[model samples]
Target: MKKIKLGNSELEVGEISLGCMRMNELSKKDAAEVIENALDCGVDLFDHADIYGGGESEEVFADAIGMNDDVREKMKLQTKCGIRKGFFDFSKDHILESVEGSLRRLKTDYVDTLLLHRPDALMEPEEVAEAFTELKESGKVRYFGVSNQNPMQMELLSKYLKDDLIINQLQLSLVHTPMIDAGFNVNMQNDPAIVRDSNVIEYCRLNDISIQAWSPFQHGMIEGPFIGNEAFPEVNAKLQELAEKKGVTDSAIATAWILRHPAHIQPVVGTMNKGRLQDIVKASDIELSRQEWYELYRAAGNDLP
Candidate 1:
């Protein structure tokens, strides 16, 4: 139920947001239930991408909720672009075209935020600046961000952008935590100490760019949830232990671990089941202590130098 300022913007959103990547798989009736339940659980932000469900997710979301002026005003909608069928495109024309498509599908006048889905090696910052300026001037996007970008990538984009980059979406969880692992094992000669993300956590914190954790419960790249998976028994046991102590589900404890970090990272949950959604939202209320947080971290088989 707690809200935080979203990056450098004036928007105050819930600590936990809903990720709509799999919403297209649900029926309109079921999707409606999911949306309604999310709002009831104090989630005010929804994240999407141009290619999710082959663009059917956005269409289904709008139709399921029977989107109206009132309904649109109550929640913050975020969508990402740049990734194409066979390549990444940050060209001005592609950026412009992508937002128009998203708007038409979402039935919204403007998205609360727009993000580059992933890094585009062929990106021209000048072209991106031009596209973003046009979108801002035309009232199609209110804020801008990037996903899976490192500090240098963001810095390069920031140099040409007229507006500040507000959010950087990344993968972070108990099992998939390279960003956090490198921080603890700094300067050590270990696999965990190999810095891959360029200290993005510290970069985001110092720059006030909110890091939105995309897979808080997943172990690998969309492999599956680790909460109840037999492969992750140690962490699951630790999660269960903490859940019982806090009177919440093991999933909630996992989510709370992400929220406990001082960086103020927000987790974008993608569960479609209303009951599971409610259980996960309980994470916003539970606060994990430093000792408990590290215990869960170590139980996940992560080594410290």
Candidate 2:
């Protein structure tokens, strides 16, 4: 896999990141196989959230990987906090407590990156800055980021953060692409013109925040993967054609579509199936051209004009 600098941070990571949200469902043996497969595929970043499987995913991952410092040093581990049982929390108390929980579960002293899993409406940036300063000073978290956040939201948090927010994880894919759609349909009286998330894609690019694309194959927030979903025949056909053309799996074509962007967005693969993980890695080498990228955009029922 290719290596890319994580935003303005000094950490360089794999072009593709593995989302460990599903790890808790697997046994330790299976989880270890998945981790080994991911490592063999050049995936070096593992993304997690405190709420994922009620923190069991991180625990399973730590046990599966043996929590060896020498092995951990070869990869980058990034986990998230800021969400609570029924609400979001970014209080200094919550942030500090959450980090401790994560470290204890992951069996690590410090994570490579710690992200706010989601935005807290009642968040005070000063408290977050204090928590981050403490974490950084004490060697608990090396870098920081956010997930599903907008430009102004980050601007609010960055106001008090001593370090740059290096990442903004977003829900993006070939089908669920409001960000790309809004960029082209701007100033128009159409449904696609709805500027969601304050057009954070361009904003993050301009601000040097790397985007991490989550659920790259999903059709909607909850509709699940679109690869074999019968509702998306056009997209499935297009993906099949490209997959055969490139001698890669259809899943790789879907993943490559996201990585094709100049933003250098990292697609966080959530699959635990070893075969599927190997297939997804094929995306790292196939760079989609401008026409191919737009073809996919249109195939997913997106209108250019």
Candidate 3:
């Protein structure tokens, strides 16, 4: 696997990390095998969110891998907070409470990184800063980041945050390229040029924040993956063609398409199947040429000016 620095932090994580979102779906033995497979594949970073499987995902992961220092030293843990049942909460109390709950379920003293799951419109940056201060001083979290946040949103928190925000997790893939679409369609009258995300990619690059690409193969948010879905026949045909040429799984081709970007994005593969996860991790070894990358991009129903 390819290793890259996580933002400005000293932590060097695998370019293709594993997201433990569906880990709760597996039994103890299956979860253990999945975790083992990832580690064996050189994936040291494990991503988790408190709301995944109603917090049972973390519990399953913790049970699968003991929380002792020896095991913890071999891997890095990153989890998210801020999403409540029906609303988003970033208050100091909620942040602290959520982290404590995660610690209890994860059976760890301090997670390597803690991300704000989603932007809370009513968030008080000062309160969050205070909570982060306590967490850092208490050694409960080593780094901080946000998920699904735009440049202005991160700027609001960065203004009051003493710690450097190292990551911004967003949805990105070959078929789903809103961030890329707006860039190329800047002067067009089409809806693709509407600038839904305010050029977050450039903003993140300027600030040196690592972009973590979630759902690298999914065509829509919370929808079926694009690999073999009939809705994306064009993309599937191109992916299969490339997979044959590259001698890797079509899933790896799908992931390598994301890794080819200079943004140095970390693709969070959330597959529970060990074989699928292994195939996806192999993307770190595959390199796509400029022509091939654009070919796959255009195959996904995107156009160039």
Candidate 1 lDDT over 1-305, as tens digits, reads: 89998898998999999999999999999999999999999998999998999899999999999998999988999999999988999999999999999999999999999999989999999999999999999999999999999999999999999999999999988899998998899779889999999999999999999999998889899698898999999999999999999999998999999999999999999988999999999999998999999999999998766
Give the alpha carbon lDDT tens digit for every residue of 1-305 in model 3: 88999999999988989999999999988999989899999999999989999999999999988667889988999999999888999999999998998899999999999999999999999999999999999999999999999999999899999989999999998888998899989899988888999899999999989999998888788887888899888989999999999899999998999899999999998888888888888888998999999999899998887
Model 2: weakest 10-residue lDDT segment is: 216-225
**Which regions of candidate 3 fall more than 4 Å away from where they truly are?**
none
lDDT digits (tens) for residues 184-271 of candidate 2: 9878999999998798999989989999999988878987889988999999999998898899998999999888898989999899
Best by lDDT: 1
Cα lDDT for residue 230, model 1?
99
Angstrom error at residue 284, model 3: 0.9
- Candidate 2 vs. true structure, TM-score: 0.98
Where model 1 places Cα greater than 4 Å from the true spot, the runs are: none
Q: How much is 86 displaced in model 1, in angstroms? A: 1.6
